[model samples]
Target chain A: MALCNYYRKRKLMDNLVGWWIRLMVFLVVALPLFITASLLSKSWLILGHISLPELLFSSVWRPLAGEFGFWPFIISSLWVTFIGLSLTAPVCLLSAIFLTYYGSRRLLGFMQPIIDILAGIPSVIYGVWGILVIVPAVGKYLAPMLGYESPGFSIMAGGIVLSVMLIPFVLNILIEIFRTVQHDLLDASLSLGASKWQTIKHVVLRKSFAGMISAFGLGLSRAFGETIAVLMVVGNVVGVPENLFQPGYPLPALIANNYGEMLSIPMFDSALMFAALLLMVVVVVFNMISRRTIIYLESRQ
Target chain B: MAMETTKLSIQNLNLWFGKQKILNNINIDIPENKVTVILGPSGCGKTTLMKTMNRLVDLQGGARTSGKIILDGEDILNTRRDIALVRQKMGLLSQRPTPLPMSIFNNVAYGLRLKGIRGRKKLTPLVEKHLIEANLWDEVRDRLHDPASRLSIGQQQRLCLARGLAVDPEIILADEPTSALDPISASVIENQFFKLKENYTILLVTHIMRQARRIADKVVFMYLGEVIEQADVHEFFNNPKQKMTRDYLQGAFY
Candidate 1:
């Protein structure tokens, strides 16, 4: 009779634990989706009337005349993101590869903690640095060389600051992933008469391509969502930029510059919400694509 | 076997890893076009000796060496010799089969490509030839473009063998190559080694006495960072020179 009671109690505890695990898994996936869905629904009423193509492609966005074209801000966002990525990718990747494969022990030990500290720095500080240092340098030297006026508040400035901001984020992740490439694989490459460069190129980089892509995705997401540094330099102009030298307004900057006065205008709050929704979607899509690519590559392996 | 030319000669080789002696005054003359198996217990530095031949040992941090490793009348221990060039003359198979992250064809073609061989037409035949030589072409012929990692562990080992062969190395260094494989795969690798000995100098490291008996043409028995015996495979098994060799062969204690 006692043994039967013990068995019954054990079965009940197992059932309860299983239920708890199931609930936790469900919440992990569902919670973020639910919150984002609720936010999106809140903006749906006004967003329903505005054609997405107009918001995406049209350049003019005048609030008093009831014109709401978001092309300029969205395009600027994409422009700055691409510019930052283009600047940051090669530098961080090369640094990461060198540190992981060829750097001396003392150098590697010194650089790793420095990179960690860089990653932990606040965004607002980067903005201050850009204003006090980069802006003046560009205005005094780079702009004059390029035959441009001394405004210094341009897309190039934003991209330059953003790239510096993203270096540590991308490099730290890449170094770790590069380190995880199997030691035996490295030995195999070296033994096969491959030079250090060849080994890194054909083996280590190829093996970690998916992880690198994800790092890029994360960097892109951060660049897109970054507000303070970009707001300080992007000139706050809602227009299409002709070149890197021209001042422009990206989405995050637009939202930051407008969210305070959103309540005064009709449909303004909904439009800002829509912008937030678009930002969320773009980030989510980039992250999902990276995740799926990694999964696909892993499955192949 | 009147007299075989020494393909690689190690004289008074000593290695230290931060005050801990790993290889102590080792001396061995590896003959040309022969399968020389180094048999020893775990931690006997068999793998270390093989790696040292290919100059892969110095890659380890704090690994210090004092030795004269002469290959083809040149001292390979000299830093002036190109490491890539040194490694190119010797192919290595690690304990686990590590296929490069690429197609089966590319894995074999990697070394060839590094030597500036280009164009699909040129590469395809050489890849096929090496694959055939490694005895893996028939199984992988249909899936040449597929990822090399998709194959079984045994097949991967064969693929790695094919990759090593494509480099045209005169010497092949295999460190416990078949240790990770099943019996059938092990036999396949062993058979390849037997055939490959006619063209290439094969240096195999293994603790398995049965395997040493099966494939070794020349045997070098090592124990505790020292070589106890160097003899013909038949004589060594039938008549071991040293007490340690006898004890090791008798399965007295590993």
Candidate 2:
């Protein structure tokens, strides 16, 4: 009778613990999604009769006059993200290859800690560095060399600073991914008389292609969402940039710069919320695509 | 019987990994167009010795070697010649099969493509030929373009064998090529070694005494990083010169 009572208490405890776990999991999973849906619904209702497609397609962004076209901001964001990705991914990939395949242990050990430190640095610090260093360098030398007048702030400066921020971030991830390429595979390629370059190109790169793409996606999302550093160097002008040296503004900077005046301006709150929704969608889409590609690659593996 | 000619000669080869001596004063004359199996217990530096022959040992960090590995009268230890060029003259099969992350056709074609062979017209027949030689063509001919990793472990090993042969190396270094395979696959690879000996000088490292007995024309018996006995297969087993070799053949190595 005593043993039966002990067993019944244990079963009751297990049921209680199981119920707690399910509730905890549900709260964790549903909280963010619930918040996002509620926010999106509020913005959609506030948007009222203003069709989203018109706002996206139109180039005018005069929120003061009730005109809320965000096409220029969208374009600028995409343009900067493109420039950052194009510059960062290849350079980071090559550096990763160099570190993993050709670097000596001592050199790698020294570089690794430095890379970790660089990755941990704040974005605002990068902004200050860009203003003090990159802007002046571009204004004094790079602009003149290219026969362009410099205002000391341009999309090019933003991209350069952003690339510097992203290289170590992407490189750290890629190096780990490349390291996962089995040593036996490398030996097989080498034993087949493949040079180091050939082996890296054909075997190592191919094996880690999905992971590398995911790394690029991370860089892309970060580039899209980055505000403070880009704001300091990107000139904060809301227009489609004509060239690399021209002033431009991205979506994150747009929202950050204008969020203070949102309550006073008519329909501006809804516009900015819509923009936030757009950014969220983009990040979600990129993450989804990368996750799907990684799953596919792993399935093949 | 035809007179055996030396294809590779190792003279007093010594290898160190960090501070530990892995291969100590090794000397061997590997005959051309024959299967020479290096039989020893695990961790006996048998794999290290085969890797040293191809200079694959040099790829390891903190690995240092002294003495010479002469291949066709060229000292492979010398750094003057291109490592890839030297490596191209020999092929190596690892213990586990690692197919390149590509289709079966591409895996075999990889080496040929690197050596400047291109165009589907040229690659298709050559890939098929090497696949046939590796004895994997009949099963995979229908799925040549499928991912190489889709094949079973045994088929992958044979595919790796085909990939190795695609380079047209004069010497084949196999490090326990069948250790990871089941009995059927092991027999298939053993049969491949027998057929391959007609054209390539095969250097195989295996701890399985029976495998060495079945396929070796010449045997190199290693113990504690030193070769204890090396002789013709029959002589080594029936009349071992060293007591160590006799004890090893009789399953005394622990």
Candidate 3:
């Protein structure tokens, strides 16, 4: 009887462990789908209802006449992402250099909390802050000096906010990449008569090239998809204006605004879903390229 | 007497990393054109002593030092700029094989480029000569443009030597240059050290006694942050004066 009881308890314990692992796996795989089910399902339903040709070439984004062409949004978004990454890349790259090369223990210890705080700041908060602070600062003061009429809540504001949001992300990734460079290689380069700057140029950057590309791609993708911050400051104009001071709209904002209204105009809603699908493809391509680069680098090493 | 000779001298040297003392009253004379081997057990201040000669250990946080180290009659701790120049003057090869992540040619040419030599024709032959001296030329000369990291462990160590020599350093400081290699490669490295000493003063720290017997002109025995014995290789092996040295020689501690 005692032997049978011991075997029964052992089986129970093994079953408990197995059940616990299954629960963990369920949480890992099911949580994201559960949370985003409404949005995804809505997009899918709209996608199924729309005809093929109308979804393919419709770029007009006129909400009043029900003609919502998405070309202007695409153009504006591409430019914003380009400008945001261009601004973020150099500053974040330089910051990563400072963190890795010049930082003492005390300096890094002090910077940790600041980076955490920046990383925790909400996108909407950045949007509101950018509108209140940057728009006027650039519009009333900096714009007049630069000979521009009105540098309003347009590309300039959106780009600045997007850049700020991407800084912490880029910084975090780059800091790790920079830290992974071996000290022996650093010493090897230094003892070889390479000056500090020369070492940075030749060995430091050379070793981290793939990782840097991955980080920059991630930052670019974030800027491209950034919605709340861009929406709050972008002034939500439909047509592409010629200058930086004019209002604009991008894909994420268009999707967010029209996802609810698509119930009334199912056709327009399907068109929006198709837009989401297109943007997803773009991001997927970026991610694939980044992964390929990282994998290629790993294979070389 | 000191003006025209004597590459470096250490007198009454003591080093401490914070509260933990690592080197105790070390004294030695590093002669020019000869290879000196320092043999010790683990945590015996041998590596610390090598790093101190070029002031590499001095920059690490909380590391403190006393006494004097003179390189060609100048105090090592007098200034930072001069210390850097001395560090540049002494090419350092760590225990592991460390080549720059570059082409075989660039690995050797890296130092030359730092000195502001940009001409390809000039850099190429100089690199070829140093690689030949390092005993890696015949194997790698055909693929100088290929990455240096693709070479085997022994080949990488030789490439490191070529890089060090390319800098034209007056002295070479090696901290266990062959502890990472196989026996045959280790012997090959020992041979290169013999050839290299004709031009550069070589100070090597080794845990291998046989290697020291084969290559070292002078041997310094260290234990527990102190130098227990210093003598010519033959003398130290045949007749160690101190009791601790005798015990170490008998392989009791190892």
Candidate 4:
């Protein structure tokens, strides 16, 4: 009777644990759907008022006059992300390669804490740093150097700040990717008379091509959604940027800047919700496409 | 047997990994155009000694070495010549075949390209010739553009051999090249070594006594990071000077 009771209790405990695990898994899958559905329902108010094409393509974002065109914000988001990625990719990749291949143990040890601290810093702090350092440099030094006269707050400032913020994040992933290449493969290449640079170019880079793409893709998504730092330096102008030097407003900045005061306006809250929904959808779609590309590359290999 | 010209001579070679001494005062003369087998049990520093010859041991952190490795009248250990030049003179075959992450033809052409040979017309014949020399031409001739990773273990090993040979090295350093293969594949590699020794000096590292007897013209026996005996293969087997060598030959202990 005692043995039978022990077995029954054990079975009951196992059943309880199994149910808990299943519930956790279901929640993970359902949470995203729930958020998306709520966002869709909230944004439908404005979507019903105007078609998405007109809302996305028109740039006249007059909140008081009741027009909510998202074209300027979308373009600003793309330009900032593009400039950030362009600056970040090459610098981070080269740093990762140098650290992995030629860095001494002591040098690596020294760099580890610095990189951790960089990655741990808040975006608000970065914005402050940009305001203090990058803004003046752009306005006083860079504008004259480039033969332009304007306030420092522009898309260029946002891109430079975003690139600095993203360096450690992208670099950490790339270092791991480069390190994942087999040591024996390196040995084989070295023994074959290839120099260290040659081996890295032919073997390490080739082997980690898929990983590099995914790392860049992740960097892209992160850059696309970065809010405070970009907003602080981007001048928050509601227009399409004429050039890299022009002031522009991105989607996240718009949503964050207007969410509190949006309740009084008729469709203002719905428009802000639409902006959030758009950001979420773009990030999700980009992640899906990169994931598919990675899977395809790995299978072909 | 007639004495052959000395191709490489190692004198007073000692190596250390941190505080642990790995190769202790090693000395050996490798003859040209001959299969010189370094026969030893595991952890006897056979592979380390070979790695030192090509200076691949420099890659290991905390590794310290004092040695004089003379290759073709040049002191490889202390020479001002480029390390790449030193490595280019010797082709090393590791235990497992590690094909470069590329198509079959490209794996062979990689070395050729490094030597400044470009264009398909120049590379195709050379790649084909090396593949033929490695005895893999028939199996892979149809799929030269297929990824080298898709090849079987045996075929990949041959591809590595072809890649090594494409660089036209004077010496072939094969560290248990057949150890990862099946018996049939092992025999095929052994046959290739026998034929290859006519043109290139081969230094083979192995623990298998039967394999040493089969392929070795000159044998150097090692124990606990020291060279115990060195002689012609027959004499080394039949009349070992060291008691350890005699015991090892009789299968007393590994």
- i-RMS values of the candidates, in order? 1.1, 1.2, 2.0, 1.0
lDDT of 3 by residue, A116-187 (tens): 799899999998899899878768876677788765778777888898999999998898999899887877
Order of all candidates by lDDT, from best down to worst?
4, 1, 2, 3
lDDT of all predictions, in order shown? 0.89, 0.89, 0.82, 0.92
Give the B-chain TM-score of model 4.
0.98
DockQ, all candidates in order: 0.80, 0.74, 0.53, 0.75
User: TM-scores across all candidates?
Assistant: 0.94, 0.94, 0.90, 0.96
Off by over 4 Å in 1: A1-12, A296-301
Worst 10 residues of 1 chain B by lDDT: B77-86
* Quality of candidate 2 docking, DockQ: 0.74
Candidate order (TM-score): 4, 1, 2, 3
Clashes (backbone N, CA, C under 3 Å), per candidate, total 0, 0, 6, 0
Best by DockQ: 1
Candidate 2 is graded, for docking, as medium
- Which ranges in model 3 have alpha carbons more than 4 Å from their true place? A1-59, A63-68, A298-301, B1-5, B79-84
Candidate 3 whole-model C-alpha lDDT, 0 to 1 = 0.82
Give the per-residue lDDT of model 4 (tens digit) for A206-282: 89989998999999999999999999998899899887787889999998897888589889999999999999999
Best by TM-score: 4
Tell me which residue pairs clash in candidate 4: none
Better of 2 and 3 by lDDT: 2
What digit string (tens of lDDT, one per residue) describes model 2 on residues B208-251?
88898899999999988998889999999889999888887787
Model 4 chain B, poorest ten-residue lDDT window?
A: B58-67
